[model samples]
Target chain A: MFGAEFVPLSLPPLVIGSLAAVACALPGNFLVLRRQALIGDAISHVVLPGIVLAFLVTGSLGTWPMMIGAAAAALVAVALIEAIRRIGGIEPGAAMGVVFTTLFAAGVLLLERSDTSSVHLDVEHALMGSLESLIWLDGTGWGSLFDPEALAYLPPELPRLAITLTIVALLTAIFWRPLKISTFDPGFAQVIGLPTTLIGLGLVSTAAMAAVAAFDAVGSIIVIAMFICPPAAARLMTNRLEIQILWSVLFAVLSATTGYILAGYGPLWLGADNTVSAAGMIATVAGLILGLAALFGPCRNRAGAPLGA
Target chain B: MLLDAFTLGLGYNATLVTLGSALLGGAAGVCGTFLFLRKRALVSDAISHATLPGVALAFLVMVALGGDGRNLIGLMAGSALSAVLGLWLVQKLTRHTRLAEDAAIGAILSVFFGFGIVLLTVIQTMEAGKQAGLESFLLGATAGMLKSEALTIAIGGAMSLLAVLLLRRPMTMVAFDPEYASATGMNVSRIDMLTMMLVMAVTVVGLKIVGLILIVALLIIPPVAARFWSDNSDTVALLSGAIGAVAGYTGAALSASAPSMPTGALIVLSAALLFTFSLILSPRRGLVAAALRQLKYRDQVHMRQGLLAIALQQPIYERLTLNMLGKQGLLRADGVPTDLGRARAAKALLDEERWRALRTLPQFEAAAARYDGLTDLEQILTPDQLTEIDAHLNRPHGVPA
Candidate 1:
């Protein structure tokens, strides 16, 4: 399994998926605590329309315009949700529901209206993400790890996701105090001179950044699953935010690695030839982890926890 | 072709799709009202996405059993089962774990859908899956739909609509005031379950028409739009049904008129169009109505402040106030009050004096609270009460002394 073909086929997707999963999971800790997990879901869904609009505007499947379009869409979705909630006096959840669904439906309609068969732009591709096809074509074996020549040909998502994950991690570590304070008690944080509103906005913006970067690699399913499952399972495992962050990172890496392995080889073990969707398998594994945590984790119930009650 | 489809002259299958989608829309709208009222509208989203795995599973199972996997009822049943499981998992997480409801919803939504996507890939690899058309459930496909399937959807929609009508009273009561309903010998939780089940049924039934992803739109957009037209729950429910029906009919017709038009997206877009119109045009709560009301109030304030300035012989500096007074012939171009302006100013002064006197009386306390400077004293106070207050006014202070 560690032969020439394995490094070429499996290493890049695994690393990219793991990096993307961690990228989503880091911000997810704060979001799950703040009861804003759905914002990730909403942001991911609205990215569809953004990319579709981008494609129609530029008439190319270039990654930068699509990523920019997705980021703009996320911002638009957030602004729209806020606008609808304020103007229509609609609840936040319902407002988010209306805005994201409308945008996603519009994306679907546009995709159908425009001719996209020649490009790799189907709803399935958009949803499942061709993670398996993101192969390291130039690598020969495990020895390619030290080869700068082979490294130069690595999929762009690896570097992009690494940067995104680094930025998200740095943000988390740098603002750990304010994030925890605001997530726990906004009024107290405000009384103490913390910019609670800006802090909240920054947190959401960070999550959006993570979501947009991870979307092209693992798809929205893993983005959403990583956002909720790892942190949620981590939340159940411990009371301290620091330890919870550690646990969440651990869980995210585990889910991505195991899920990719299972998706690629689990069917073979069961005597089947075809592989399943890695995005789906990753999400399922994350859910299974969360389910296990919910069932047997030390702090699963809300006896002493004050977060997300 | 589009016009013929809209007029229900497109043929039997197209007509069936249009009418069935309308009935489903109406039912979804009415059922969704209670969900929106309860502020858990996205619960339907989780349930809708949860149906995907069951669809693939149902197809796989049917194909294994030596029958075609295109049975509408079996697919619906399978989807319904999974949606219920998803709903149950959400409820379990919310109730049993430290997870908030929204987190539970997100968890269930993504995870179940991810699992479903896996199943879809699995089915795709199978021999029978080549023509499975399972992707239709993702975004419904209406082309070459069988008669039996259309009839099943129509009958299913009508039954759910009937069920919604029968249960709207209790569901509305629970949604509006759950504690009160629970105290008044109603099972609020059971009613909530009923609401979820109805939403789930609509979701499963709608899978072939509106697709799972946008089914929540049919349930959500109509009620939200209807809310602008009325505050009364009953009116909103009925009106929501009507709006949803219209959107459904129009969307299905449009989908049939073109080759590329998707039924679900068109349906959602139609509903969103109605929502946009309602947001702008509804007489009571719409944006235009709110702006108009504000404008009327602002104009009245300007007129009152301008009139007060005239009564006191104060120079009117604000342009809007001056313009308003001039337009009413209350002030001249030289900023002098016309005779009509002066007379109205004097009456305004007298009304202010009457209000001041009334505010001092303990018996007129409730009436005094209604005072805005623009409100006519005569409108709120009866003539007898006004006379009593007027009797208490300072004895004609001579020449503004």
Candidate 2:
């Protein structure tokens, strides 16, 4: 079932998609609990300014600094929204709209102002990422780690995915108890001195990491898909957080790999060149999975629970 | 710029495009109010993103049919169809599935956008000529717009205007208090559909100017800005339209000034700025009003404190201030001054103390004594009230005093 060609294309997307999925799923779980699902969307858009500023400062796409820059921008986006809420007297969504849209617009204007040689991204192209490109990134970077003949020979994107997954996993492991207690009852958690603010900040930073990782894999437009879609689909099937995480991981890996392959064949089958990108297609499929889960997930009786109820 | 428009031949085209864009923005603003209230602001994003594939497919179909360059009609038709399909899918998912409303929104938005990306890529590689003008729907181009295109916008804009006008009563009733509307047999579901159609139409019309990613800004910002000024729905809707129109015009003109500028981002920026202004300065709900209210309350507290000092008549000096502070923090009740404990005697001593004081002369003592005798007791709590407060504070948690 898993042949040589399959090992290269199918195995890599699954491995990377699973890592990326696990990373986002943890933050996605808390985001839903916070009733700030769109925070991911806002953070994703706001992180662009940081990425651009980081590039200007460093003049290179070095991973750690870029990630730090993006995370800082995401934190600033959160702060901006809170400031707008306090100063502008708008609700979270309106504040988010104002802060994120303006920041994203500023990011675009800055990109336009900068030289093309430093980075080659238009606003639209930056919002979308091509996963097919990830499949063929430098595959011989780790040759010295093994005997000269038996090199590591892994894709560059996969290592980033792995690193991101490790960070997500470690954070989740260290903060699982606090995250759960805080998410379920923030007032009580506060009374108990649980440091909900730190947990909330940590969740936001994790989401930023997910956005940065998924941004290269799927782009900003569809990162929301990977970030929100799997957990959402899994949500339909179960109410338990553990089950939701498991199912989200399962759904993201399955959908991304399947979407990538189907998109590859879209031109072959549909007569058109299948302009449908693998990331976008994966997002669509993940949405479809969520839709199906919504329809058939066992917890139908409680589907209409009103906000704050 | 307005004078430049008068001199330059391109100015005429700019004016025409501005008018159309303004109308589109106004219509989007009015419709977006209902969408925002429905918590579907991002729906505009989904519908806008989804339109790419619709436009691609529409153009491909038109090409295969040997149609002329008037592919905008097909594209519009295709966008409308896809938007409705996307809305339907969202509704179905929410109604039938265990997924939350936000999850449904995210899911639908991503999927449709993904499909649009796929379609655009295919068009890019295989049948490039067929979709020559279709890329405009992604980011939008105002320079190429003609009178005919403006006419289409006007018609769509007018239709949205009419829908808002005709359904104003039920729409407001449904948006504010849907349960009551349904209880009153107003066909809440029908009203919802009608408003959704209006919202859908606005999304479709926006394809010409703001394009996909930023179309929601047109619908969202004007209403948000207008919200600062009005409590009544009628005023909100009207102000929203006005703001929307102004933003539309400003963004379009800005983009026209520099051909390289993206029109969608300019429109979004204008709306966001306007909304931010309203958020800070609106009449009732704006930040300035809240700050003023807080300031006025502080002044009242200070005035009351000054009056209380005169009534107490306890040497109104730094020693009295220190004594008062010590009383509030006592580890021993014995530390409270005996003269401070005697209400009637305390007032007499305060009166005598004020008369002896250098600040007030003997001639003014009569007026000051009378004023002091008038009592600050009216503002301070009675004995019974103080006992009730102490009882409440001393009461156990969860047991009423």
Candidate 3:
């Protein structure tokens, strides 16, 4: 049944999830184009130790410290991968496997050793977020937005995600030219004095920030899915960078909203009593969208588009 | 205390788990050599993550069929099937569509894990599913392993080891050069599939021990570490197996001693430690060895250059070079080239001239082995004639020297 409690419980997650999805998908397009798609997965995993270390130092799970720590960790992961590849002559994927797993294992060990009960930060929650419990019911209906007390009662995650998404959008729009040039043709971009390396690093750091912001709400798995799937699907649907970005945002928002709704209510419709993980559902839905696009999209048979382009 | 723990201080279950994990690690290392050679390290990661949903589905089916849902064979069968399916999807996505291998791998990994999480949530809601203990598949729970499970791992490990041994020739052939294998009328695809099957078997069996997230570390770290020690594929495979076995044994023993440590992470960290050691200190292809070789080569080149300069009547550049060459009986103390030094200097000068000429010629650019063809270089050009040829080559294409 359409109950009063469902609307208040489901709305905030849907909004936060979509925002996180859009934020991640923006930078994901560049990563896919540059053939560094797995870097997102690597960054997401390596940031675990950073988040845990930040919590240890600050004694609180504040956004700035965690974001800064996670960004630093992601950069360290990237640097280590490069160093291992150059020094040891190991393949990039294997180098990534070595670094991220060790970092993640260290994070897990640290979390287990520390008293994480007070911080509500455990390995399980780090991998799979508690989206079902993010209920926003401080005040009911649209009238509550104007009330000062109700405004203060808004779910903290909503604002953090919104601000992160806005920064991603603004930076993406401002640097769209260099990002596109560097991603498509770094040699030419360098020849023209575009600071391609700097742009590339900035893009990766932005992705890390988005990843850390989304980690608390949707978990790292969903963050990785959003980072690759929507951009990849959008890539299959379009060739122009602008249209691809729009399509990516569109696919991400749709997946987030639809996956959240389905996770919350789909099981009930199927005569089950419990809801599933919304973050996992979002990733699955994003994947499903990608599968459909890969099959039926106009660029499906274009061999050079996805990776080589 | 450590000796006792390694000897027999632990109980029977702990000892059995340690031995079983060591066997599993050995098999995984041997199988991983081929995968690493083929550059499919991340593919194993994808398959491991993709097995999660199959595990959940198998448990659900077993429960439905009046079984305890913990049947290891049934669960492994389901996991293998899904992992192969995931591999097929990766192949299809890469071959038929425009997605690169990494994108395909990332897509399959996240999606399958997502579905598995959904199924896990569903299972948790069921009546007896809390006892399923499937969450251990994420990070592994070696402490909770049963004797029967340990036995199964041992048998599975031995079988995979036998498979790798039996198919070593074809797997190595296909891994290093598939085109050559196919050219020689071998079924490269079938060999590749067989290797995948062996990998799948080891991976599925290892799920209860190392879990999905860290399982690829077992597949990757050992072979890579072994590569630092030897160039022969057979030696590499053998050393990888040995390193993996030692890592497994020590990690399990340590975990048994310290009950608080997670066995999977400890095992991976141990392998990583071995990898670091090999990377820095292996006798061949290691950083330290390479740096030492570079220094020795530099010294030899410096002595030879000094001899050549002295023979050519150029001013001596370094007193250390002169003293070192004199100590080596190649140079006179008066800074003049000795007869032995003169012969060596003339040979080195001819070699340099030949190298410069060959490098400047674009026709010889691709053939690195062509340098060996210049055997009569001394008869070909004297020092004065070498200068003339060098000047001629350095001039503009249409201009006279």
Candidate 4:
């Protein structure tokens, strides 16, 4: 079933979307546990303006400039959120709503006001990135997967996402202990001199890193969905941090592959002429997984049976 | 040209759209105040995003039924159905699983919006005539709106306003203190649901004009900006609605004046401008107010310390204290204390002594609790109490005790 066209047209986006999903889902476990899952949402919104401004300055859609601009905007958003919360005496959610919405509006306004009409940088493109078109243009067939000449022409997003996934996994592994302590009991973490504020900032920064990268690869719907859904669904499966992370990875990969195939072929299977949005399908799939977990996962209840230590 | 648009001189269609969005913005503002107060402001975000699929599906359904598929009412019905489903999922997940309300919000918004995008792509591939309007719902399209759609938005906005007016009392009480609201026999959850419904009504109505991305900005920005002006819930709601209306009017007018300006983004940027101004300059809760209060408190501290230094015959070295004391004509050219300064100094020193004794006295606890170094001693102690305390000082200078 997987033919020559499939290798070049479908396989790259599938791999890139999965890498993006797993990258976001890793830190998502801690974010979900810490009740800060929406950081991904907030970060994704701000990335638009950053990408736009980077294009404005460099006048190019090169990958690195976009990433840097996105990272810078994410930092500004984090700072702005905190400043508004403290200065306005507003709740975190409201402050966050105010900041991200304003920034997103600004991004939209900038796009309209600027002369970037010739580029592929519209609001719809920013939101629902053309994940289906990130094709491996140089591939010939299955054997091209190992041919260095063929691999050299792989879509740029694959290596970028792979690197981001590595960084996210490494950060989680390095700060596993402090991150766990702070997420579970911040007060005790504070008493133990863990610099809870810095730890919290670090966690948000890690999430931002993953968010900006995944947003680059798969658009924002996937970024936001992977950040909360996979980790959240896994949270119901077990209370153990280690197992939860592993489960989230499995779920994210499943959502990405299944959702992409559904988007690419499900319409044809059902006798339609065209495919649907891969990002949206993946999000829909993740939500289904979450619904199932919410309904019948082992530790789905609020007060799960205590660990039999 | 811009002035002409703002004055509603941009012809019939633009005028109708401007007025329509103004009403929508105003209604959103009123509901947003209650939502923000209840800490459920972000819930509106989830609701708005979830409406996307409904808009797309509503179009497809209309087309399949042999209709043109651009009916405002049909699209709104579709949007409302999907939004309700999304909201129901948020509530269910928050209640059933260990997922926090925010996590549920994030999940529902992304998934539903994603599915909506899928539907949107499907519609794009269809050979329909009027399906072009579907994309405008993403960010809203005020330009070129048919007069009928604009009028529907206007009427919908007015009805939502009336609804908010009627629901204000229960909403205010429920938003501020849900426990009190529930104890008073009001169904708090029902009130919250109503508030969410109001937000959605405005969202659906405004969707044709303002788009999905920025309608929340209208709902959230005005209420937040209004909050900087007033602490009273009712007043904030009133002011929020006014701000929302003005922002909508201005944003629409400005966009109408130009070719490339998108209506929804301009409207939100206007609201954001208002928020920025309020954050910096509002008299009650703004940064300027907070800074002024801090400066005044600092002045009081310096004045008190300077007086005490003058009384103790100490050479004051702090420039701020010296400058402030001199500004009040309490210092000579050579920096010696004047007669008025000496009298002030003596009172200041005596008050400091009185504060020291008051801390040890059990009977004056309430009076002593207000004893910041800046509070005048007489403001706390009665004349009789001061005389009794002076008698204990053993100097007995003020009244020859």
Candidate 5:
């Protein structure tokens, strides 16, 4: 449907989105097994404060500083949430609700107070990253080797995406067994002397970083769509961990491509100014797929069933 | 201050918001009591997020129908309709699919919120000027509250209270033990649905106060906080409602004074802080009470050990009078052992090494009788303090005959 010009425009979003998907999926596999599926929701909202704080200090969207800061704040949030659960005797879900919402509120207030630009680089940018702009940046200089051999020089972001995905792959490979055991049965894993807390903290931080990465493609709110939807959908199709991870990755990649292509063409066909956010559309699509899976998956119990017979 | 707050001047608008939010908070508490018992504490959360699309669509329809874009009726109708749809979808997905309840909630929440965002973006483009006021529902805008909204909240709050009063007996029975109620042929699903509807209604009422995002806190924190104060279920529910109302009013007032303060967060923080206090100092179940009980028990065990040590030093041949017992460190040197002194000196150690077996039983009586050669001091110790001490001592022996 698109000319050669549009194909290249679509490639960066797809590439970055796939990297985000892979990153979110690796940790999300365990998050689901740990029954912390909604943890992404908490992390998405909670990381806002750190992003705002980082921007206040740096006054720009420098990725590493903001990412590192957000990751740290997310870790603090996780620790505080755990302490609230243990010391205050609050339920996990409620504790999460309290911590994340409070942090998000603090972030919003901080964003308003910061004398930064009117564009609201803290939350709005994080939620709707400049995927459109990032996809078309000029790859100049000796960056020629990083180019796609046949088509054109690769965007600098392509290599960053690769590095992020590589990090995710390496971590998942090294910690696969411990992560799996810990996710499935934390109590037993703790009894066996596995450092469940460290693993848990690592997973939470990785999810936050995945959120930062996805922010560049889909934005923050839709990052929840990336983190939760595919893992949830994969859960319906399989009980085996390896299979679930594979299916999750596959679904995420497909959703990203579909979303990118659709966003590229959707506004054009409707006589609009390409205003439809690629990341937001992709998130919606992911949610749609997950919703369908939840409605048609093969195994269910009747006792706490959603609807009456 | 009260007169100024209720004066019918320009300040009346703020009063409406305060009172309406307070009433809504009470209603949420009553509905939440049943939810907590049902172990369905997360249902309100699901409904809160899932209602977003409903509100957005309602606004869309309002515009489409040539109605005023800022009408509250359109918004309320939209929320009710969408909430029902979300609930129905959740049910259908759970019944026909393999999804767990939590999974179903997650799916509904994401899809509905995402769709709501899509609609919001569409509407924002189409009706940018008129959409400014509508954003309040997303983050709550008590500044926009009027007398009419307050009246609707009052009526809804009253209806919720009346419904709880009517269903109190059945709800109590179901919450305390749902399996028993089900086995007894109570219409469990009907009761559950009705309760969920009340919870949904409560959430709808709270939309103006805490907004769409944070209403779940209203439904969760107050009732749990109240649990620490009262052992009886009815009292807990009642106290929960009171606490919620107080929190609601205070939050609105504080939010009015503090610009840029989100009302929902303030309200939830107030409730959370109150819960912390309840956890520490409530009379029956508070940490302070439990700690004090432990301290008292330890003192009794120590005192009993002192008396037993003194008694064990006595010869088997000699019969020691109450006066002779006073000479040992177990009692005061006074001829007549006071109730406190008798309590300290009559420590007959348990035969079993289990410290919990150290009750005021005949083992103590037998040892005392051996020392006094048939005195009736054991029978003299039938006081209330002694009875509790006895229970604590005999805690290991399964309620002590």
Candidate 6:
């Protein structure tokens, strides 16, 4: 199992997928609790234009530029939703619908018109992702962890995802108290001087960061699925917020590992020669987990429990 | 060339596709009005997104069974099955969980779409999968649509229209007030299911035309636009259908003319344009119209107050008010109220005093009904009666005047 082929070809994707899943799921718990789960979906769609525009201007697929572009796009999406709601007097969901779809359409048109072959960001990859192709072979085996020479040659996506997951973990740990109070009861939190608005913005920005970091590795569909599914499933399984977070992390890891393996080798067992999309499989597995949990979870009858209770 | 495109001289394909889109728009608009009224706009989104897996699975099964897998009916069956399942899941989640409707919709939409992507990838890896043309269902490809497909859409649209016609009264009743409808012996849930089935029909047919991503706009924007124009449900539904038709025809024509523009996006943009126009300029609920009414009311109030001041021999606030009143024949231009102006000013003063008294008195709350019935000027309290009530209310508690 620890052979050279296994370490390079298979290990990287599993690790990358798992890291991406964990990164997204951490912020997703907050989103699900706040009932703003769809904002993750909207951010994923709206970031397409930002990524494309960043590539067009910089003429490179560098990580920092793409992340910056994605962040700007996410901000624009949130701002546009607010503006549409206030000016047009439309509901928030409808405002989100109008903004994200229009932005996604604009992204598609721009991708079609521009020269994006150099960046490897085409329309298909924008929607489905190119997860199968992210392979890493710097050195051999577990020993390469300490070898600086080997680390230098590692796949860029690996370290990017690792850093993103770390930042997400650090932020969640730092703001854990405020996040819980503000998300559960903003009025009381504000009355107690908890800076509820800033906490809310911080949470949204953290979700945006995770979305952009995972954009190239697992794509938006998996980002959206992981953001909602595991947390939602975990939510069904537990009542305590801390326990829910633990369950969510566990579910995210399970889906990412199992789904990737299924996508790669499951088809062979079914007599097919080629493997399927790892990102799609991961999402499907997450959905399956969520469906099962919804049916048999601990909180099935306690569905009407108050938020954050 | 522009004229040719405008006149639809491009040929039969453009004409057929345009007509098919028009029919779809009309049906979706009618179904969407009920959905919107019931505050289920995002439910359509969830249903449409959920159809993706069904479509891909249908294609795969058809191919596995030794067929080309391009059969429209097979694909539609798969889509309808999944869409209904998605709606059921949404209903269950909302009913059984602490999740709000938006969270449930968001969860179902992403998960189903993700599964669809998985199936699509699986299909992609199979032999001859490239020829399946399954990807077009994501964003739509109107140019590739055949006349037969167009005909199928038209037939589906016609069925939805017929259903709405047959169930108009009950549908409206349920949409407006389901509790009342149920009290009146109508099966509210069954009626809701029937409406959802109609919406599912339109949504499934619309997938090939507008695609999954933008189809909800076709369903939502038209009826919302029509709402600004009419108070009657029937009129709003009719106007919604008309607007949908226009949007479909124009969007298709523009797509045919400009070859590069995506048909679905253009259609949604057209609908958005119509919605913006209605929001700003509609006569009943539009911002511009409401603002004009406010300005006119302000002018009338100013004129009335100025005329009262003059009749009571008090100070005139604005000099132009007296001039405007005289021009309107409410004043004699001699800085004194004419006979008509005097009567009008006294009535206005009396009505103002009565409202003030109504606001300050706690015991007179029951007299609100009397005040509502006294809209006629002759029925208003006399000056002496108004002064007596004012003096009585102004005294300290329990002190009789």
Best by TM-score: 4
Candidates arranged by lDDT, highest first: 1, 4, 3, 6, 2, 5
Tell me the spans in candidate 4 whose CA falls farther than 4 Å from its real position.
A306-309, B129-131, B313-315, B331-340, B394-401
Question: What is the C-alpha interface RMSD of model 5?
Answer: 3.7
Q: Please provide, for model 6 over B1-401, each residue's C-alpha lDDT reduced to its tens digit, 9 standing for 90 to 100.
A: 55665577878777777777787888888888888777777788889999999999999989989998888788989999999999999889878866667767877887888889878888887786877888888877777677777778777777777776677788889999999999999999999998888888888988887788778888888877888888899998888888887887777777777666677777777777887798789987788887899888777767767756865778675777867788877777566677787787777776666566665667556554465422532355566655656675443565567
Query: Model 3 — TM-score against the truth?
Result: 0.86
Candidate 2 vs candidate 3: the TM-score winner is: 3
Interface RMSD of each: 0.8, 2.8, 1.4, 0.9, 3.7, 2.3
TM of chain B, each:
0.95, 0.75, 0.80, 0.95, 0.75, 0.82
User: Which portions of model 1 miss their true places by more than 4 Å?
Assistant: A305-309, B349-363, B387-401
Give all candidates' CA lDDT scores. 0.92, 0.69, 0.83, 0.90, 0.68, 0.82
Write down the worst ten-residue block by lDDT for model 2 chain B.
B330-339
lDDT (tens digit, per residue) of candidate 1 on B266-362: 9999999999899899898788998999999999989888888899998889999999889989899999999999999988988988989888999
lDDT of candidate model 2 versus the reference: 0.69
Residues B1-401 of candidate 4 have per-residue lDDT tens digits of 98899899989888888887888888989989999998888898899999999988888989999998889899999999999999999999999878899899999999999999889889888999334568889888777778888788889998998899899999999988999999999998899899888988988888887888778888899999999999888899999999999999989889999988988988998999999999999997889999999999999999999999999999998999999999998988689999999999999999999887777778878887888889978887789998777666746466754
Q: Which stretches of candidate 2 lie over 4 Å from their true place?
A: A1-14, A53-66, A86-89, A113-118, A135-156, A185-193, A265-276, A300-309, B1-12, B38-40, B68-70, B129-133, B306-401
What digit string (tens of lDDT, one per residue) describes model 4 on residues A1-309?
487699999889999989999999998998888888888899999999999999999999998899999999999999999998999998988888888988998898899899997888888888888798899888888889999998999988889889988998998999999999999999999999999999889889988998888887789999999999999999999989999999999999999999999999999999999898898999999989999999988888788653342
Task: Pick out the ten consecutive residues of candidate 6 chain B with the lowest summed lDDT.
Answer: B372-381
Give DockQ per model, in order.
Answer: 0.80, 0.47, 0.60, 0.82, 0.26, 0.40
Candidate 5 residue-wise lDDT, B1-401, digit = tens: 43444342237667777777787778777778878766667667678877777787887777788876556766877887788777877777667655556656656666666666666666677754244465567656676566777677667767776777677778878888889999999998888888888888887777767877667777877887787777688998888888888777777776666456667767776776777688788887677887899877665554444445544544222234333445553455533444654454444543222223333454554343343212333454456634544565533666558
- Give the CAPRI rating of model 2: acceptable
Colliding pairs, model 5:
A127-A219, A127-A220, A147-A154, A299-B98, A306-B91, A307-B91
TM-score of chain B of 3: 0.80
By summed lDDT, the worst window of 10 consecutive residues in model 3 chain A runs over A300-309
Q: Estimate each model's TM-score.
A: 0.95, 0.80, 0.86, 0.96, 0.78, 0.84
